[model samples]
Target: MNAPYLLPAMLALAVGTYALRWTGPAMRHRMRLSPRMIHLLDTGALILLAALVATTALPAGTDHLGLALPTGVAVGGVLAWRRVPLLIAILAAAATTALLRLLGVQ
Candidate 1:
């Protein structure tokens, strides 16, 4: 493997990721989004999050289901529905997942 190339590649990827993230707020400040645009952006973000979750939960060629995805989703849903604090929601999700794994549920 080209070890020397790895650092530069990783740095480039990181910088690109940062640029993409910053593009949103930078553009937002310069150009206010319309209500429709805002709604579209919100939906897009949710879709991206769902895709990320799905990818993590169900990796390619995996036959077994994992508890992490379902537990995270459940916790997130509960938090949203109950209007729970963000920190508590995160902790609850992490703890629940850990406990489930410890008990060998998945």
Candidate 2:
């Protein structure tokens, strides 16, 4: 929310996206993973994905959001786990958060 930080944040995000796009193909020729290694990599990716979500949902430091984020995340996670389409799951989560906030939930 800091105006002065926006450019730096956007630049960082762009760099991160660029890195993610480039890293796999860039290193692909350097190593070949075994099946077990592939599985572990997949699992590690999933864990990192979850960790990112958790951090966003339950933020630390100064600008504290609230429990509504995590509650909505749980709803979204259940829908996703039940094989709901990605868009629907995301909308459901957003709706949940909005409704909770409207109802004065912290």
Candidate 3:
């Protein structure tokens, strides 16, 4: 938590994250992705994104579910159902989250 240590820690984290992201692309030429491998990678990415959303919106040791879960659900539903624009999907999720929070659903 020290100021000096913070920079090093952040740098390491960034590098590690970058490496993980680059792993698939880096191996693209060397490896062919089987259907199962492709599915697994896609699932892994979605799970990681869900975890990030949960952490940011729900946090830890909190009873409130907040706007994250519902927003993610809405966005997923829209993506699955229709060929909507990315911006529209994002806006819909944000709007839904705001409405849910305003209604005291958390």
Candidate number with greatest TM-score:
1
Native-vs-model 2 lDDT? 0.84
Q: How close is candidate 2 to the true structure, as a TM-score?
A: 0.55
Among all windows of 10 consecutive residues in model 1, the one with the lowest summed lDDT is 49-58
Using lDDT as the measure, name the better of candidate 2 and candidate 3: 2
The parts of candidate 1 lying over 4 Å away from their true place are 48-72, 80-88, 100-106
lDDT of 1: 0.74
TM-score for each predicted model, relative to the true structure: 0.58, 0.55, 0.49
Across 13-37, the per-residue lDDT of candidate 1 in tens digits comes to 9999999999988897688779999
- For lDDT, candidate 1 versus 3, the one ahead is 1
What ranges in model 3 sit over 4 Å off?
Answer: 39-72, 80-88, 97-106
C-alpha root-mean-square deviation, each candidate = 4.0, 6.1, 5.2
lDDT order of candidates, top first: 2, 1, 3
TM-score of 1: 0.58
**Candidate 3 — worst ten consecutive residues by lDDT sum?**
72-81
What is the model-wide C-alpha lDDT for candidate 3?
A: 0.70
